[model samples]
Target chain A: MRKDSRGFKIAFIILLSVLVVVCFLLGNAKGTIEIGVKRIFEVIMNDDGSTQRMIIWNIRLPRMILAALVGVNLALSGAILQGVMNNPLADPGIIGISSGAGLFGIAILVIFPQHQQFVTIAAFFGAMLAAFIIYLLAWKGGIQPIRIILAGVAVSALFGAGISGTLVFYSDRVYGALTFMNGSLSARSWPEVQTILPYTIAGIILVMIFAQKLNILILGDDVARGIGLNVEATRLSFTALAALLAASAVSVIGLLGFVGLIVPHSVRLIIGNDYKYMFPATALFGAVLVMLSDTFARTVLSPTEIPVGIVMAVLGAPFFLYLLRR
Target chain B: MKNDIIMEVKGLSVSYKDNKVIDCIDLAIEKGKIYCIIGPNGCGKTTLIRTMSRSIKPQEGHVFLSGSNIFKLKTKNVAKKMAVLYQSNATLSDATVRELVQYGRFAYKEWWKGSYEEDTKIVDWALEKTRLTDFQKRKVNTLSGGERQRAWIAMAIAQKPEILLLDEPTTYLDISHQLEIMELIERLNKEEGITIVMVLHDINHAARYADELIVMKDHKIFKKGDPWTILESDVLKSVFRVEAQITKDMDTNKPIFYAKKVI
Candidate 1:
C-alpha cells in the first residue's frame, strides 16, 4: 500500500508538470490573434520582431509568467501557514497577510500616488507588520492556533476597515485603486514577474529545506517538542516566511485570495501531508490553477476581462464551504 | 548525583492563573523502575508528570535529569535522555504510521542531511517492537485507540530514551486494550530498563504493575512507597478519602485494592 501511494504521488507530480506545460501552451496560443502551436514555439525559440512574436514577447508571456508566479507564492504561503497553524484551512489571508498588503497597496494608489514606485515595498511592510501584531496577540507564553485565528480575524477586520476608509474618502481616486484592490493583472508584464520571482524562489527553497521539521510539527505540539523541536521557534519562523510569500504575491497582484486556499487544500486532499512531497506538488499545481483560471478570466467576457481575484473569489468561497462541510 | 537516580524534582511549582496545580513538589526518580502516580481528579498527577517531562515549564525550581537542570539543557538534548507521550494523538495530518514513527529521529537529525541507514533501522525496530509493521501503512486516524497508543509508544522509543514519562497512557481504552497497553509498557520497562513514570487513574493497575506508587493530594505528595505499604486501608482513606479492601494477587503476588466508598 505504501509503495502504491508513493507511485501514485510520483505519477500525480508528473501529471502536474504536464498540466503546467499544457496551460502554458493554451495560455500563450489562445490570446489575441490566436497564434498556432507551431507559431507559438517559433516565437518562443526565435524572437523576431513580427507582430505575433512581439505580442507574445511583450504582453502575453509576461502576464502568464506573473500569473504562474503568483500561483506559486500564494499556494506555498498557504501550505506553510497551514503547517504553522496546524490547520489544513490556514492561509495567508487567515492571518491578515493579504489584507494588510491590500490596504497598503490601495493606500499608495490613492493617498500617495507620488510614491507609487514603492507600492510593492509598502505592501510587503504592511503584511509583515500585521502578521507581527497578530503573532504578538496570539502569544501568551505559548502559541495556540485558536488564539492565532481569533487574533488574525480581528487584525484582518481592522486592516480591512483601513482599506474601506481609504476608499470611502478617496472616492475620486477610486478608479486608479480599483484594479489594484480587485487584483487585476491587466497591464502586468516583465517588471511584475521580476518583482515576485525572487520571493517565489526563496520561499520554495526555504520550505523544501525545512520540510521535515514541518512534518515533525504537524505531529502536534507535545510530540513535536518531545521529539526535540523548539515548537514556538519553528512556528514563528515558518509563519514569517508565509507572510513573506503572501506579501510578495499581494504586492504584485493586489488582493487575490483562494489561490492560497484552493491549491494547497486540493493538493493535500489528493496527495498526503508529507511536507517534502506537499511543497513541490503545491508549487506545480498552484501554477496550473492560476494559469487556467486566469486564462478563463481573460477570455470569458470577450476582452472585457474581470480581475483574476474575482474569478478566484467566485470559485474559492464555495470550495471553502465544501471543505468545511467535508 | 547518585548513579541510580535518573531524575530529580526539587521545589517545583506550577500554576494556571490563581490555582496552583503543583505546589513545591520534590521527588527522586530511580533508574529502571516503573513508577505510577495516582490521585483523585485535580490532585496534580498530570501536571507533575508533564513538568517532569519538561513539556510544562514550572514557575519555580528545577527538574534534574542525571545531575544537570533539565530546563537548562536544549530540548533536543533532553529528548535524547527522555521521551514523553501525551494523551491525545489528534492531528490535522494524514501521516501513516511509519511516517509518524520516522519523526522520532528528529532529535538525532541534521536538517540539510538525509536520514541515513541507522535511522531506518531504528524506525524498523520501533515498528517491530510495537507490532505495528502490518499497520504501518495505515493513516494514524484509521488506527484503533490501542493501536494508535502503541504507535505513539513506538515513536517515543525510537528516541532510545532512558526515561519515559506518560500522562495517562491508558486513560480511555477498554479493559483488554488497557491491559495490552500496560503489558507493553511493562515490557518496555523490564526489558529495556527505561525508567517509567506514568499518571494512572486505575489504582489497581498501578498496584499490579508499578515497582512503587506515588499518591498525591492537594498538589502535594501525600505518600509514596511500595504498593504493599501504600495500599493499606488507612493510607487509602487518608489520601484518597476512600475506604479500601486490599488483598494480594495469587499469581503476581502484587497488592490489589477495591475502593468501598468516599469516606
Candidate 2:
C-alpha cells in the first residue's frame, strides 16, 4: 500500500511538471509574436526584466493561476460532496450548486451593475443557501444523500428558471451576464485571482484537516455515528466547505462544468478513495486540466479567442457521455 | 447485581414524526454477559438498541451509562463508554481495512494529533482479534460478506468501549460465518468483561448464545430473563405469534426452539 501511494505521488509530480511547462508555453503563444522558450524561461527567472515579464506576470499569469485555483476548488468540492453523499453522480453541477451560483451572479449583474464583486459574493452566499436548503429539506432526523440530491435537483431547476427570467427581463445586461453564466475566464485579472485565493486556500486546508472524518462519513451516517463521529455536524461542515469552494470557483471563473465532477471521480478510480491523498491529488489534476483547457481556448484561434467555457463544454460533453456509457 | 449493571435504559420511547417506534422500554444490561433482544420484524428491537447507544434520541426517557445521563454527555464521551455496530453493511469509498479500523480512534485523539502509538496499538489489537490483519491493505469493497462483517466488528472493537451494541450482526452471513461471529461475541464477553447487547432474528441462536434473552412485543419487553426461563413456547407464541416447541439442546442444555406451525 505504501509503495503504491509512493509511486502514485511520483507519477503525479511528473504529470504536474509537464502540465506546468505546457501551460507556460501555451499561455505565452497568444501575443503579437510567439514568445520563444528561452525568453519565457528568462521572463520567469528574472522579475521586472522585460516586456515578456509584464505579459507573463501581469496579464497571463493571474488568469493561469486563477484557472488552476478554481479547478482545484471545483474538483475538491465535487470529490467531497460525492463522498459525503455516497453517490457517484452527486457532482456540484448535478446537484445544482453551480447553477445556483450562476443564477445569483446573473441577478447581481442585472440588478446591481456597479458592484461587480457583489456578484461573486452573492454567488458564494447563494451556493451556501442552496446547500443549506437541500440539507434541511432532505433531513428526516439525519441527512440522506439520495434525498439531498433530489432536493438539489428541485432547487437547481427553480434557480435555472430564475436565471432565464432575469435574462428575459434585463436584456441589456444579457451578453455580459451570459459570459459569466457560461463559465468563462476572459474577464479574469490579478484582482480576481487575489479575491479567490484566500477562500480557496482556506477551503483546501480545512478539507485536509477533516480528511479522516470524511472517510468515515462515506460509510453512511449511522455507521459513522457508531464509531463516535458527530455525523450531522461533520456532514454539515463538509457540505459548507464544498459549497464555499464551488461558490468561489464560480465567482472567479464563472461556472466551469465537469472539472468538479470528472477530475475527482477519475482520481478515485486510479488511487483508492483515501481523501488525505485523494483531496490534494484531485486539486492538482483539476488545476492542470483547467489551465490546459484555458490555454487551448485562448490560443486555438489566436486572434479570435474562444471563451474557455465553450471550449470545456465542447470537450467535456463527449467525455461525460463516455463516462455514462462506462 | 450492582457490579453487573453497566448500562440502564429507563422509560425509553422513540418516535418518528407522530409514529412511535419504541414505547417506554426499560432495560438493564449486565457487564460480562451476552444479552440478546429477540422479536419479529419491526418490533422496535433495532430502535431500542439505537436509543441505548444514543444514535437516535429517545423522546421520553434517559439512557444511563455507568450512572451518568448518556444524552447529556458529549458524543465522544458517550462513544468512549459504548460502541454500536449498525445493521447496514455500507462500504466506504476506497477505504482500506486499516483506515476503517483507525477511524474508531477518532474520539481519542484531538484534531491536530494524528493517529498515535496507542491508537495504532488498539487498532492492531482489534484487527488481530477479528483476524483481519492479513486483509489490512485490502479495500473494504474487495472483502467478502463475512470479511466485511468482521471488518465492521473490528472497527467497533477498536473503539475499546466498555459496552458493545450490535444490531443483527449476522444478518447477511452464511451459517458458518454466523456461528463464527457468535463465538467471537461470546469470547469477548467472557474474556474482556465487555457488556454486549444485540438484536437477533433467529430465536434459536439467541437462546443458545445469549446469557440473557429479551423478547420485545408491541414495542415493549414481553419477557426478560435467562434464555432457558424466557424462551418458553408460550412466550415465543406471544412475541412472534407462532406456535413453537421449546426443548433443551442436547450438548449445552440450553433452550432450543422449533416452530411447529405458523398461527
Candidate 3:
C-alpha cells in the first residue's frame, strides 16, 4: 500500500507538470503562433515588452487558473459527496446542485437584468437551497443515502424544467444565458477568479478538516455514532461544503458536468478509498483533466472556442458509461 | 454482584416514531462476565443492546456507565469505556483488515495525531487476538462471513474498551464459525477482564456461553439471572412459545436445551 501510494504520488506529479506545460503552450499560442517551451517560460516570467507576455499574463493566465480552480473544486466536492453518501455515483452535478445553480442563473439573467452579479449570487443560493431540500426530504430521524439521491433527482428535474421554461420564454437573452449555462472559460478575468477563489479555498479547507470523520462515516451511521462521531452533523457539514464548492464553481464557469463525477471515481479506482489520499489526489487529478480539456477546447477549433463543458461531456460521458458497466 | 456493576440502566425506554421499541426496563451489567440477552425477533433485545451501548438514545431514563450518566458524558469518553460491534451487514467496502481495525483507535486519537506506533501495535494485537494476523492486509470485501465477523471483533478489540457490546455477532456464521466467535468472546471476558454484553437469537448458544442470561419479552426484561437459573424448560416455553427439553452437559455441567416444537 505504501509503495502504491508513493508510485501514485510520483505519477500524479508528472501528470500535473505535463498539464501545466500544455496549458501554458495552448494559452499563449495565437493565429500562426508557435513558441518554444523555454520562451514560453521566459514570457510567463519576464514581462519584458513582449506580446507573448501580454498573452500569457493578461488573458490566458486567468483562464488557466479558473480552469484549475473550478476543476479542483468540482472534483473535491464530488469525492467528498461520494464518501459522505457512501455512493460511488454521487456527484454535485448529479445531485441537483449544478442544475439548481443553472436554473437560478437563468432566472437572474431573465428577470433581474439590472443586477449583474445576480448570476453568481443566485447560483450559490440555488445550490444551497437544493441541498437543503434534499436534506429535509431524506431526514426521517436520520438521512439515508438512497433517499438523498432520489430527492436530488426529483429536485434536479424540477429545477431543470424551470431552466428550460425560462429559456423558452426569454429567447432574446438566449445568447448570453446559453453561453454562461453551457460553461465557458472564455470570458474569465482576474475579478471573476478573485470572487470564486475564497469560497473554493474555504470549502477545500473544510473538507480537509473533516476528511477523517468522513472515513469513519463510510462504516455506516451506527458504527460512526458508536465510534463517537457526530454522524449527522458531520455529514450535513460535508454536504454543505460540497454544495459550496459546486456552487462556487458554477458561479464562475457555469455548468461543468462530469468532471466532478469522473475524476473522483477514477482516482478511487487507482488509489483505493482512503480519503486522506483520495481527497488531495482527486483535486489534483480534476485540475489536470480540466486544464488539459480546456487546452483542447481552445486549440482544437482555434480562434472560435467551443465551450469547455462540451469538451468535458464529450470525453466524460463515455468514461462514465464504462464505469457503470464495470 | 453490586460491586461488579459496570453499567446501570434506570427506567430506560426507546421509541421509534409512535411505536416504543424498548419499553421501560432496568438492567445492570457486571464486570468481567459474559451476559447475553436472548428473545424472539423484534422483542427489543437489539434495541436494548443499542441503548446500553449509547448508539440509540433512550426516550425516558438514564444509562449510567461506571456510575456516571452515559448521555451526559462526552461521546469520545463513552467510546473509550465501551466498544460496540453492531450487526455485521453494515455496509463497508474496500477497507483492508488493518484499516478497519485501526478505526477502533479513532476516539483515542487527537486531531493532530497521525497514525502512530501505538496505533499500529494495538491493531497488530487485535488482529492477533482474532487470529486474523495473516489476513491483516486483505481487503475486508474479500473475507468470508466468519473471517469478516472476526475482523469486526478485532476492530472492537482494538478499541481496548473495558466493556464490549455486540448486536447479533453470530447471526450469519456457520455453526462452527459461530462457536469460534463465541469461544473467542468468552476468552476475552475470562482472560482480559472485559465486560461482554451481547444480543443472541439462539437460546442454546446463549445458555452454553453466557454466564448471565437476560430474556426480553414484549420490549421488557422478562427474566435476568445466571443462565443455569434462566434457561429452564418453563422459561423457554413461556418466552419462546416452544416446548424444550432441558438437561445438563455431563462434561461441562452447564445447562443444555433442546427445542422440540412450538407450544
Candidate 4:
C-alpha cells in the first residue's frame, strides 16, 4: 500500500508538470498569431511590446490561470463534499450548489447591475442557501445521500427555472448573461482571477487541514463520532467550505458542470481513497483536466471559442457512464 | 454506588420523534467486567447502547463517565475514555485495515500532525490484539464478514479506551466466528481490564460470555444480575417469552439455556 501510494504521487507530479507545459503552450500559441513555444517563452521573458507578447500576458495567461484555479476549487470542493456526505455522486453542479450560485449571479447582473462587486458574496450565500435547503429537506432523522441528491435535483430545477425567468425578463441586457450562463472562460481577465484568488487559496488550505477529518467522515457518521469527531459540527463546517469553493469558482467561470463530479472520482481511482493524498492529487488532476479541456475548446474551433463547459460535458459524460458501468 | 463504577446512566429515557424507545432506566457499569444487554428485536437494546455511547442523546437524564457528565465533555475527551462499535461496518470509502485503524488515533492527533511513534505502536498493538496483523494491508471491503467485524474491533481497540461499547457485534457472524469475537472481547476484559458493555442477540452466547447480564423487555430493563443467577428458565420465559431449559455447563460453571419455543 505504501509503495503503491508513493508511486501514484510520483506519477501525478510528473503528469502535472507536463500539463503545465501543455497548458502554457496551448494558451499562448493557438489563437490568431500561432506563436511557437520558444517564442512564447521569449516574449514572456523579454516583453518587447509586440503583439504576441501582449496577447500572451494580457489574454491567454490570465485565462489559463483562472481555468486552473477554478478547476482546483471545484474539484477539491467536490472531493470534500463527497467524503462528508458519503456520496460518490455528490458535486457542486449536480447537487444544486452551482445553480444556486448561478441564480444569485443572474440576480446581481439583472437587478443590481451597478453593484457588480456583490456577485461573489451573493453567490456564496446562494450556494449555502441551496445546501441548507437540501440538507433540511433530506433530514428524516439524518441526511441520507439518496435523499439529499433527490432534494438537490428538485432544488436545481427550481433555481434553474429562476435563472431562465430572469434571462427572459431582462432580454435587453441578455448577451453577457447568455454567454455567462453557459459556463465559459472566454475573455477571462486579471480582474476575474483576482476575484477568486483569495477564496480559492483559503478554501483549499482549509480542505487540506481537514483532510484527515474527511477520511474519518467517509466511514459513516456513527464511526466518525466513535473516533472522536464532532460529526455534526465537522460536517457543517466542511459543507460551508465546499459551498465557498463552488461559489468562488461559479462566480468567475459560470456554471461549469462535471469538473467537480468527475475529477475527484478519477483521482480516487488512481490514488486510492486516503484523503491525505486524494485531496492534492484531485486538485492537480482537476487543474490539468480543465486546462486541457479549455485548450480543446478554444483551439479545436480556432478564433471561434466553444464554451469550456461543452467540452467538459462532452468528455465527462462518457467517463461518468463508464464509472457507473464499472 | 460510586466506588467502582466506570460508567453510570441515570434516569435515561430516549425517544425518536414521538415514540420513546428507551424508557427511564439506570445502569451502573463496574470496572473490568463484561456486561451483555440481550433482548428481542426493537426492544431498545441498541437504543440504550447508542444513548450510553453518546451517539444519540437521551431525551431525559445523564450519562456520567468517571463522575463527569459525558454529554458535557468534549467529544475527543469522551473518545479517550470510551469507544463504540455499531453493527454495520459498511463504509463508502474503501480503506486498508491499517488506514482504518489509524483513524482511531484521531483524538490524539492535531490537524497538522502525522502518525507518531506512539500512535503506530498503539495501532500495531490493536492489530495484534484482534489477530489482524497479517491482514493490515488488506482492503476492508474485500474481507469476509468476520474479518471486517474484527477490523472494526481493531479500530475500537486502537482508540485505547478504558471502556468499550459494542452494539450487536456478532449479529450476522457464523457461530465459530461469533465465538472467536466473544473470546477476543473476553480476553480484552480479563487481561486488559477494559470495561465492556455489549448488546448481543444470542442468549446462549451472552450467558456464556458475559459476567453480568441485562435483560431488556418492552424498552425497559427487566432484570440485571450475574448471568448464572439471571439466565434461569423462569426469567427467560418471562422476559424473552420463550419456554427455556436452563442447565449448568459442567466445565465452566456458567448457565446454558436452550429455548424450546416462543411462549
DockQ of each: 0.77, 0.74, 0.62, 0.82
DockQ of 1: 0.77
Write down the TM-score for model 2. 0.93
Model 2: lDDT of residue B63: 91
- Angstrom error of the Cα, residue B158, model 1: value is 0.3
Per-residue CA lDDT of candidate 1, range A49-140, in tens? 79999889888889889989999999999998888876666667766888988788778878788877777777877887888888789877
Candidate 2 local lDDT, A113-182, one digit each (tens): 8888687678877887787777778877666767877898898887778877888899887676676656
Kindly state the number of residue pairs that clash in model 4: 0
For candidate 4, give the lDDT of residue A120. Answer: 92
lDDT scores in order: 0.87, 0.82, 0.82, 0.87
Off by over 4 Å in 3: A1-34, A102-122, A140-143, A164-175, B89-92, B113-115
Off by over 4 Å in 2: A1-6, A30-32, A44-54, A114-117, A140-146, A173-175, A322-326
Candidate 4: tens digits of C-alpha lDDT, residues B32-85:
889999988888999999889888899999999988999999999899889999
lDDT of 2 by residue, B106-180 (tens): 788786775588898999999998899999988888898889889888888888989999999999889999998
Please, what are the lDDT tens digits per residue for candidate 3 over residues A1-326? 36345577557646766766666456555323566667767987787988777766777778888888898899998888788777777777777888888888778877887875767778877887888887788777565777887898888888877877888899897565665666888868788789788877887687777777888988888787777777778888887788778888887887888888899888777777777777777877887888888878887887788898899989878986786677
lDDT of 4 by residue, A1-326 (tens): 36445676667757776876687577668776788888878988988999888988899888888988998999988998788777788888888999999899778978898998999999999999999989888888666878888998899888888988988999786456666666899988899999999988897788778888888988988888988999999999999999989999998878898888899998787777888788887888788888888878988887788999998888877876786577
- Residue B101, candidate 2: Cα error in Å is 1.4
